[model samples]
Structures are given as C-alpha cells and as structure tokens.
Target chain A: MTLHAIDLSVSRGGVAVLEGLNFSLSPGTALVLRGPNGSGKTTLLRTVAGLQPPLAGRVEGGGEEIAYAAHADGLKAMLSVSENLSFWASVFGTGDIVAALRAFDLEALSDRLAGTLSAGQKRRLGLARLMVTGRAIWVLDEPTVSLDAASVELFAAAVRTHLGQGGSALIATHIDLGLDTELLDVTPFRAVWRASDPDEAFL
Target chain B: MIALLTRDLRLGVRAGGGFGLGLAFFLIVTVLVPFSIGPESALLARIAPGILWLGALLACLLSLDRILALDWEDGSLDLLATAPLPMEGIVSIKALAHWITTGLPLVLVAPALGVLLNLPGPGYLWVTASLLLGTPALSVIGTFGAALTVGIKRGGLLLSLLVLPLYVPTLIFGAEVARRGAAGLEVVTPLTMLAGITFGVIALLPFASAAVLRINLR
Candidate 1:
C-alpha cells in the first residue's frame, strides 16, 4: 500500500498551518517529517492519519491502513504490560503478542503494571503497542520521547524490521533514528499569513 | 466489540477506577433522604419511586465523564478512531460498558434501597423494570453529552448541563411508570413511552454521539 497526500492543507484551531503539501510513501519505505516548533508537523500527521479532515485535499490509502501513535502512550496504568499489549492486539484483530513483547525487550516486565515502569520503559511499552496493530502505515508524532540511546536503537530496529516486511512509517521527530528513510522538510509548505485576513490578525 | 466492553469492565472494577462510586452515591442519596424526611413511612413510600428514579439518573450522570475522558486524556480515543472499528460501534460499546458498570448496578440495588424507603411491594418490580428499560437510554444519552464536552477540561459540569434537559422525557416516563405502578394504576402508557425513548435513543443517538466525537477529535 502507498500513503499519498495531495495538495493537502490542514489547520490548527481553525487557522491554516500547512498548505499545498504533497507526499507519498510506498510499501517498504519510511518518511520522516522535519519542521520546527509550531510548524504544523503534528497537524500534517494528524490530517494524514484521518484524525481530522483536511481543509481541501483528501488523503489516499491512509485511513484504515494507518495506525497513529501520538505523544500520549495510550496505556492503562492499572493493566499489566502484557495485558495492555493483548488488549490492543485484540483491538487491532491480531493475536500472539509474544513477538511484540520480545521486539521491545518487555518480556521481563510483562507482569508488572504499566504505571510502575520508568519513563523510558513506558515509552517503550507504548512503541511496542504498534507491533500489535498490524497496520501498514504508522503515523507517529515524536514517538521517541523519553527514550535513552539504547531504547532509541531498539525502536530504530523495530522500524527497520517493519519496513523490511513491507510496512511504512511517517514519523515526526527531531533526532534521526539512523534508518534508511526519506526526509520531507515541511518548512516550505508553511501557510503564510496575510494582513487582510482577520484570522491571521489574532494568530 | 467484546474486547472493548471487557476492557472497560475491567477498568471499572480496578481500584480507583470509579466502578462503585456511582452506586455508593445512589446509596447515600437513598439513605439520606429518609433521615431528612423524619422516617415517616407514608411519605417515604409515597416518594420512593421518584427518589429512586432521580437517584439512578444522577448516579448515571455522575459517571458520565468517565466514559470518554480517560481515553481522551491518554490518546486512546484518537487511536480508536483510526482503528478499523466504526465510530458508531465504539460509542455504542462505550455506552454498553457504562450501562453495565454503572446503570446495571443501580438497577440491581435499587430495590434494596427501596426497602429502606418503605417502598410498596408492587413498586419493586416496576422500579426495577422501569430502570432496566430506562437506564440504557441514560447511558446512551450520557454518552452523547460526554462526547459533546469531551474536549473541554473539567467538562463534567457542562456534561450534566447538556445532558439533563435530554433526560427530562426519560425521567418523566420512568418516574411515572414507577409512581403509577406503585399506586397500582395502569402503567402501559408511560411504560411504552419509556420503552420508546429507550429504543429511539439506542437506535439513533449513537450516530449523533459518534459525529460529536469525531468533531471533538478534530
């Protein structure tokens, strides 16, 4: 499957942020989104993920195939690591979280409550949830937050394995994961504000 | 669908998850009313049906924020929206889960609470039956209200505000059925109206809730 965004314009709180942006990611490849703060990186990713509709253009082949992972880890504090993963697994209609558990080196902490894990560990568990999603396109927003170097490598390896198996990822991150991925700089697509527009005055 | 239901049920039962909180509130309301009324059996019996219905409605309202706020805070709602499941299915399952956790308990323990209020014998079956038919609508309507104010922080107050007006018809029919059944009056009219509201909301409000949720997600 290929995820394509054509002439996509997205807004944040009713103001245009990114306009006329275009990108495509085929199977077995990855696209890394690069931009500065308040540059609509999150907005663009969300638009493609179908969390919010596009202002003008439509996203092709991205809705059902996309599994979004935002800054929030989406883990239940009370459920154990395995239980949390299993619940998402069942939700995504997949079974056998053993591979997911082993991918993130979470087998040891499988029985522990998610709340008890360290920050990095919690982020790891959150990233581990993607493995159970079984979707082709991953729409991740700063997925490496709170991760140490080794854990970043773990995440990098997981993405590599996913890409090797014909999956794609559209990640918004600052640090490079040392993966063979394409970089799409969003600075050019920044929607310029006009003096005549009333909305831009408040912005 | 069952997976979501079971997960919510498990979360509700977990410590500090607010499972029994509504039931406890209902109990307190039922128990406190008599003390204020001076233990007069006649007045208590006369008011038991209305009191129980109001108690159930408030208890359901109290827990309304829990339906989607937790998931919204943790970004589970976003992910669930992107999942293969339809938004309608997600909201329906959520309402079903809330009914099971909060509304179902209030129904079961309502009769027991009625005993404390000196409720007449016939009121037990009618109250329970009315709650059984009515609480699902409460859950579904509360789901809509919760979805409406989900984006706002501290939305519980606004949720109640948006939901209580919608609850009027259900409350009227529900309380009427209970009151008339307690008095041994014919109840087919209010009973059917209660069922109508329940079925109508159950059939339609999920779409409205789903649409509101999508807008909130936006």
Candidate 2:
C-alpha cells in the first residue's frame, strides 16, 4: 500500500505556499523534504498531518492517524519528561513511551521538567512523543534541531530502524539525516517575499 | 476521548500552579469589595450578586490566557489537532478542564464569598447556582476566543478585547439573578435567560472555535 498526496496546494496569508504538488511513498521507504526557509516545507508537513487545511487537493492512505512534530518542541515546560511522554502515550492509546524515550537516551531524564532540559534534550522529548503516537506515518518538521553529532546519529538510527520495520517518514530538514531517503526539493514553490495589503489579500 | 480528558484534568490539577494563583486572585477580589465599598450591611447586601458575578468573571478572565497558551507553546495542541478524534471534541474536553479548575471551584466557593458580602442565606444558593450554570458557558465561549488569539503574538490584551464583549450578556444575566436574590425577588427570568445563552453557546461555539483554530494553525 502507498500514501499519495495528489494535486496538493497550500496557501498562507493569501499567498500560495505550494501548488499542484504530487508525491507518494510506501512502507519501508522515507522522503526527505528540503527547501529554503520560506519554501513551505513545514506547511507541506502540516497539510499532510491534517493540522492545516489544504488550499486544494487530497491525501489518501494516510487516513486520520499521523504523528507530527513541529520545529517547536511541544513538551509542556511544567511537565517532567516522563510525564510528557505519558500524556502523549495516553492520548494515542499506546503506552510505548519507555522504549521511545530509551531510544532517544531520554530514560535518565524522564523525571526532569522539559523546560529545564537543553534545546537538544527538548527535541529528543518531542521525538519521543512522536514515537509513542503509534501512527503509521510520521510527518516531521525539522525533527533534529538541537542535537549534537551523537544525538543526531541516534535519531538517524531510530529512523532507519523505523523504516526497516515498515514505518514511513516524511521529514523536513536542512541538514543531512543520513537515512537512505528519497529527496523532494521544494525550491520551486518558494515565495520571494510576502507584502501585506488588505485590498490585495486574495492573492 | 477519556485519555485526553484524563490527561488534561490531571495536568491541570498537578502541574497547573497557575490555576491556584487565579483562585487566590478571585478570593482577594471578593474580600476587597466589601472593604472598599464600606461595610454598610445594606449596601453590601444590595451589591452581593453583582460582586460575585463580577468576581467570577474576572477570575475566569485571569485564567483564560493559560487555556491554550500552554498547549500551543509546548506543541501538545498541534498533536491534539492531528489526533484521530475531531478537533471539536478536543476543545470540548479542554473546556471541561477549564471548568474544573476555575468555574467549578468558583461555584463551590461563591456561597462563602456571598456571606462575606453580607448576602442573605437564600441569595447564597442563587449565587452558587448561577455560577454553576454560567461558568461552563464562560469556558466554552472563552475557548473560542483563546483559539482565535493563539496565532497572534502578544495576544493577552487583544484576547480580552475580543472576548469581553461576547461575555456581556452572560454577565448581565448572572449579576441580575444575584441582585434579585439579594432582594428576595423572583429570579426565574434572568436565570432562564442565562441558561438559554449558555446552552446556545455550548452547542455552537465549538464549530466556530475549530474553524478559527484551523486558520490559526496554518
């Protein structure tokens, strides 16, 4: 089986972010989404995750279940790392957080508040949340923001194992993740600059 | 659904120190009113309903910014937005948590505050009853406002600007019932009106909030 995004278009602030974009991926494969800062890589991931409404088109075989990690680590500052994992695990109805956190080397920091953790640590917590979601597809936006070389290696290893286990990932990132992944360059959809005009808001 | 609600409620109780901070503010406001307006028993009795309603409204307002700001900041909101459950359901459960922390406690404590304001015994029931019925509406309505403001940077003041106008009718009816009860007059009219507005908002505001959140998330 394959998940396909057909004729997809996304607009933000009345400006087209992406238009008529098409791609498909099957199990045991990955796609790396790359573009400049405003190239709509994040927007594509949001649309695929069903967080943003597509300006036009459809995503099939992805269904209602997909795990998404934005560039912002979404862990609550007040919540300890384990508590954050438990919250997501409970919501997704799959209590697999111990393994997920362990994979990110977060087991020791489980009781630490997310806000107290370093930037890379918070990113690992965010990825751990994605892992416990138990969704077939992972739409990740800059999943490796704060990691050093070793942590980045660990994340790449997790992705490789996930793909080997029949899971799929569509990642948006600037750095090379070293996964045997397909590349989708989103440079063609980049907007030069967005000018604000109330009258011309429909562009 | 239970999972989301349970997690939210637990987090609201355990990690939400801010919830306690809001309740203390509500208590302080309720206590300071009599001191400011003079301890004239008659005057205090006359304004007891208005004071309680206003206090509850302010208490609810103080806590509104935290409603979705935490989730939005921490990234949990996006996860909930993408969960298999509908966005509307997620919002509804969030409203429930808000009520448990702010509205429910306010209702439970209104009787005591009512007494402090020299309200008669019968008026205490009306104060609590109105709060119980009206606070859920406040939370549900407030969620929509919070959702709208979530995307805007530096939004707390703007949130009040957008939400306060919508709260006027509920405030009017809520305080009116308290005033009538203080006078020992029949209160079914204002009470029924408050319930009607609450019912209408609870039924309709979720869709509006969800639509706005979709835009904000983009």
Candidate 3:
C-alpha cells in the first residue's frame, strides 16, 4: 500500500503550522521526516497516521493497517513486558508476541513489569508494539529518544526487517539511522502565520 | 472489545489504578452522612435513599477522570484510536470496565451501608434495584464528561461541573424509585424512568464520547 498525503495542511491549536505538504510512501520503503522542533513534523505524521484530520486535503491509504507510535510508550506499568505486548497484539488482532520480543531484544525482560524497566528497555517495549500491530505503515515519532547505540541499531534492524517484508515506515528523527530511506524536510512547507482570521480573536 | 475491557479491569485491580478509590469514597461518604445529620432513625430512613444516591453519584465522579486521563497521558488513546476497533467500541469498553470496577461494587455494597443509614426494610431492595438500573447511566455519561475535559489540565473541577448537571435526571429518578418504594408507594413510574435513562445513555453516549475523544486527540 502507498500512503499519500496530497496538498495536506495541518494545524496546531487551531493555527496552521504546515501547509501544501505533499508526500507518499511506497511499499518496502522508509521516509524520514526532518525539521526543527515546532516545525509541525509531529502534526504532519499525526495527520498522515489519521489520528487527527488535516485542515485541508486528505490522506489516502490510511484507513486501516496503519500503526502509530507516539513519543509516549503507551505501556501499562503494571503489566509485564510480554503482557503489554500481548495486549497490543490482541488489540490489533495479531498473533504471537515472541517474535516482537526477540526482535526488540526484550526477551530477557519479558516477565518484568514495564514500570520496572529502564528508560531504554521501556522504549524498546514501545517500539516492539509496532511489530505486534501487524500494520503495513508504521508512523513513529522520535522512536529512538532514550535508546542507546545498540538499541538504536536494534530498532534500525527491526525497521529494515519490516521494510524487507514489504512494510513501510514514516519516521521523524534528528539522528541518522543509517538506512536507505528518503528524507523529507518539512521546513519548506511551513505555513506563514495569517494575522486575519475570525478564530484568531478567541486565541 | 473484550481485550480492552480485560486490560482496563487488570489495570483497575492493580496498585494505583484508582479501583479502590471510588469504593473507599463511597464507604466514607455513607458513613459520614449519619454523623453529620444526627442519629435519628426516622430522619435517617427518610433521607437515606437520597444520600445513598448522592454518594454513588459522587463516587462515580471521583473515578471519572481515571477513565481517560491516564490513557490520554500515557498515549494509549492515540494508539487505540488507530487500532482495528472503532472509537465507539473503545469508549464503550472503557465505560463498561468503569461500571464493573466502580459502579457494580457500589450496587452490591449499598444494602450493607443501608443498614447503617437505618434504611427501611422495603428501601433495601429498591435502593439496590434503582442503583442497578441507574449506575450504568452514570458510567456512560461520566465517560462523556471524561472525554470532554480530557484536554484540560486539572480538569477534575471542570469534569464534575460538566457531569453533575447530566446526572440530575438519573439522580432524581433513581432516588424517586428508592423513596417511593420505602414509602410503600408505586415504584413503577420512577423505576421505568430510571431504566429509560440508563438504556438511553448506554445506547447513545458512546457515540458522543467517541466524537469528543477524536476532537480532544486533535
């Protein structure tokens, strides 16, 4: 499946941040979104993931089979690693969390509560959720935040494997993951602040 | 849906999930009511049904924020929104989990507390019956309130402000059923109205809640 965002415009707090943004992700490919903080990269990824609608334009091929991993891990601290993976796996109607655990190198910590894991371990658990989702397009925002060098490599390998299996990923990151992927800098699509608007008064 | 419900139930049972909080609040409020009003059996019995209803309502409210705030904070809502299940199903399951973990307990334990209130013998069954029929609405409607104020910081006050008015109808009909049953009057009318409210909210509020959650997610 090819995810397309054509002439997309996204807003934050009722103000347009990125405008006329166009992008597409073909199968077995990766797109790295690059922009400074507050540049609407997150907003754009969110729009493409269908979490929130775009102010204008539409995202084609996002109805189903798209998994979004926000900065937060979304893990239940009370649930162990395997339990958290199983919850998401069941939620996405996928089967077998063993591969996800092994892929993220979380097999050793499978029985430990998510709250008990270190920051990097928790992040791995979060990223492993993508594998359990069985989704074609993985929309990840700053997925490598707390990961160390080896863990980043683990995440990169997981993404590579996902792409090799004809899956696609849209990632926003400042660090290079050393992958054959396309880089999209959203700086060009930054929307100018419009001074005159009816809703501006409310702000 | 069952998976979500089970996960929520597990979370509620775990430490710091606020599962015990609502029940504890209900018990404390029920125990304090008689002390505040003085121990006159007639007065206590006369007002017991309403006090119990109020206590249940407030107790439900106490756990309302837990319905979505934790999910929202931990970013579970975002992932769940993108899951295969519809948003309506997600909110509905959350409401069901809340009702099971919070509302159902209050219903079961109300009779025990009714003794403390000197509730008339006839009032016991009616109170339980009314609560059994009514707390589902409280959970459903409170889910909407939680979704509505989910974006606000420290929105507990705002949440209560949004939900208390909605609870008025449920509270009135529910208390009326118990009060009428206690007085040996016909309980059919109020009981019917309470059932209507519960079924109506349970059937419709999930849509509104899902919509509000989508907006908040934006």
Candidate 2's C-alpha runs over 4 A off are A189-203, B14-16
Q: List TM-score per model, in order.
A: 0.97, 0.93, 0.98
For all candidates, the clash counts are 0, 2, 0
lDDT of each residue in B1-218, candidate 3, tens digit only: 87899999999999998888889999999999999999799999999999999999999999999899999988888889889999999999999999999999999999999999999999999999999999999999999999999988899999999999999999999999999988878999989999999999999999999999998998
Q: Candidate 1: misplaced stretches above 4 Å?
A: A195-203
Candidate 3, residues A1-203: lDDT per residue as tens digits? 99998899998888899999888999999999999999999998888888887889889987796899999989899999999999999998888999999999999899999999999999999999999999999999999999999999999999999999999999999999999999999999999988768775464
- What are the candidates' individual DockQ scores? 0.82, 0.64, 0.88
Model 3: residue A87 alpha-carbon error in angstroms: 0.6
Ranking by lDDT: 1, 3, 2
Candidate 1's TM-score reads 0.97
Candidate 2 lDDT, A1-203, residue by residue in tens: 47799988876666668888889989989899888887888788888887767778988888665678887776777778998888778878887788998899998998998879999998888888878888878888988887999999989998888888888999988789888889999887554445665654653
Q: Model 1: DockQ against the native?
A: 0.82
Return the lDDT, model 1, position B58: 95
TM-score-superior candidate, 1 or 2? 1
Output the worst ten-in-a-row residue range by lDDT, candidate 1 chain B. Answer: B75-84
**Fraction of native Cα-Cα interface contacts (under 8 Å, chains A and B) also present in model 2:** 0.75
lDDT by residue for model 1 (B38-149), tens: 8689999999999999999999999999999999998889888988889999999999999999999999999999999999999999999999999999999999999999
